[model samples]
Target: MSNISQLCVILGDQLSADISSLKMANKQECLVLLAELQDEASYVKHHKKKIVLVLSAMRHFAQTLQAQGWQVRYVTLDDPQNTHNFTDEVARAVAEVKVDEVLVTQAGEYRLQQQIDSWQSSLGCTVRCLQDDRFFASIDDFAHWADGRKQLRMEYFYRTMRQKHNILMEAEHPVGGQWNYDHDNRKPPDKSVPIPPPLRFAPDQITSEVISLVASRFADHFGDIDPFFMAVTSEQAEQVLQHFITERLVNFGQYQDAMLTDEPFMFHAHIGFYLNCGLLSPVEAVRQAERAYMEAGAPLNAVEGFIRQILGWREYVRGLYWYHMPDYKSLNFLSATHDLPAFFWNGNTDMHCLSQSIGQTQKYAYAHHIQRLMVIGNFALLTGLSPEQVNEWYLIVYADAYEWVELPNVSGMVLYADGGIMASKPYAAGGSYIDRMSDYCRSCRYKVKLKTGDDACPFNYLYWYFLDKNSELLANNPRMGMMYRTWAKMSDDRKYEIRNSANKFLRNMS
Candidate 1:
């Protein structure tokens, strides 16, 4: 322990009261640093709502710390002395406060982590970056698990996580007979009954101020600023979580993969932003779902399915991100190089699925996982859109998106650019899959049944075209051999028609 005061550096995402930085530093001896830098807010032209959510949450967290009698050096985005970066702010704060030591939590993104790792020499202070205890699995633990594994699959990793955490486990065995309920969770979209809305919070004064600031500063950014009902505080986030458990979790599993026109959130918990922003804890979220299964009698399929996302997919992606960074971003296994279309920004495309998903994203800064993976992401994969271009769009558009989570999901899982590191096979599906799972096909300008005619859905032909084009690379995979065999059986004329249709769609996409 240092005799002098410790400067606790709290990043925007590290808003929790139990964060490692806060825990290690005494309130009386620590001066908390929370800055809203232009450099971070404008990184990749972030969605306006995303900027508002982070800034507002940070402001609230700082106030909460102050109520606990902690001295906080809060820097607003408009602070003229901000110098627009964490490096300058940390240097200025240490020099001004004359703190001898600095305590900080590890950053979620690698870029910021690099900057933090260098701060000790630059700031003339003993800097200690404590492990962020937000997640169940630590980076070191994940590394140990990854070692000597030929293929790192989420199912096996998820089972280990379950046992390690003692969650949904019965004395070394899973509570359920199976480790996954994914098969039961893929029911088609149903609109027979009205879908209940997720909980929404009206903007408080702090959030309103943030909205105004983001509106003026990031006017050209994608997504609507109004109707910004995102839960900016931990209390509000918990309310939303409780609401999901009581009203929505029962059906969440079955319809998790289903999509409907203009129905952005169908039995989905819109807690990604909250979870990522530190408003809610992942472990707590999992425990709550498990409790619902036991006490509230929520279906095991729904509860387990929801828990898998937070426990399995979320943790796996973060681990894989750290496991393969600085090199993972550049992996273009399929070598996709096409440009992202303008419709990604404007939602002006004739494809109903794209228009619905993108428009929802523009309005809410949200889309359920299926809309992301199957609709926008699927189209991007089949169309050969540059992985970098696709990755940037996802990073910018979603409120929950951070580089660690978004990059793996986009470059590795969605685009298959990492060559099956994150996914077993390319989640490639034709329009028929969308038709079966969503209602977008009903309203689509293109016919889902048509494979290659003028009014045919681009996904129909593009799905086969993607397979045909990448057969040399993908055919060797055990999971992809059947698709290759099917493609080989197709007549030359039909194959040509599919290829020609895909080419025409790509040409017109520009």
Candidate 2:
């Protein structure tokens, strides 16, 4: 048997050079095992671009590790003898090379964590699950902060994180005398100003090979596989981040919540695709934005809003995901049971908003946050789509989606599936909200101004229908009192018309 002291298993998502498992390992004594598993790629029919990104990044990371003198046993999915799962691969690797222990960073999802937990017994070797230190806060740290809290709100948790990390801080006080500038960041789409497209990298040889592999292997998956230009290396990812800081950060916050037809990137930083995969570090991205602000390169509203996304919302959601797991995924507070519509997959709907958002997703496997939350997710909330269905769709369609981030954002923040754990109320909205935020209504077949009848926007009646249906569960929520009072004030005939319009639309959709 070959003499190896440890077998460090690096997952596709754990591609960072400084991940915990690699840090604790001696380059000479450790055999770094990076595998492209079939089971992982097909877990939920991930978008073609997502598969390409992960596999390509993994291959590039392996090259980097090897160049740094680390011994790596890379497993390609096409290997005839490959076992196609983590447990079997680890077992095979250990049997081939005698190792004293196996080291792995804690998984980002509950399902994978359960499998990781069973490895010690199955492999008959000591298994060390290292905490993922890539984040600003540890899982245990989040747990400690969560204990004894009556309400787990992100704003309070965010303030503490800002203080702990000293991001945008002026000696214990937040910079500009404010902790949040979300109010200044919600301007509707400015049609006059030109939007700078996110920088795209030409597929290098490594990524081109991954693209061909995904195209053939995952031919049936969602999204287009060709024209895949995302950064697959840490250096490339950093370039993308720098591009955003220079060309896009000034306009990012203002148009962040706005949507426009055929404009997918919209001045928003697309680095989440890199950051989620460990090719880019969250803290580094936040620091760069803060630097830009200090240098007067970007406004405080833009800088703070961008920082809040990474340092606040991204970290907050990850904390919430781990703090409440296995049980958290099953929470469906509204009892939403409708199936995800077929149009979500093909973007064949007549609603221009959904068609635009989903069509963009189909081509690029991405949508801006507002397109995700207000347009698509809001429709799911109003129409009572199954949380399971919506969650899977969100996971499948987005390149940045991992269960840790996707679950809380979809089930908690978007669908209100976790009751009030992550959101004060369901992110429900009427057609007018979409109309005000986007130019989609001008082209939609349905009338945004109409509240009832065949041509009325489905969101209009469905919003009230959702509120009326879930009144028993949500009527007492202090934040929802205004909506409830408005519903109560509606004449019985008006309410009937809304319910009828909603039921009719839902039946047709079904």
| Index of the highest-lDDT prediction | 2
Candidate 1 lDDT over 407-509, as tens digits, reads 9999988999999998899999999988999988888889999999789989999999999899889999999898899999999999999999998888988
Query: Which runs in model 1 stand beyond 4 Å of their true positions?
Result: 1-4
Q: 1-510 in candidate 2: lDDT tens per residue?
A: 265789999988899999999999977789999999999999899999999999999999999999998899999989998999878898999988979899999998889899999998988889999999999999988999999998889999899999999999999999999999989888889899889877888998999888888999999999998678899999999999999999989998887798999999998889888889899999899999999999865899999999999988999999999999989999998899999888999999999999999999999999999999999999999999999999999999999999999999999989999999999888999999999988999999999999998999989999999999999999999999999999999999999999999999899889
- Per-model C-alpha lDDT, please? 0.91, 0.92
List the lowest-lDDT window of 10 residues for candidate 2: 1-10
Candidate 1 displacement at residue 112 in angstroms? 0.5
TM-score of 2: 0.98
Single out the weakest 10-residue window by summed lDDT for candidate 1: 1-10
Clashing residue pairs, candidate 1?
Answer: none
For model 1, how big is the CA root-mean-square deviation? 1.4
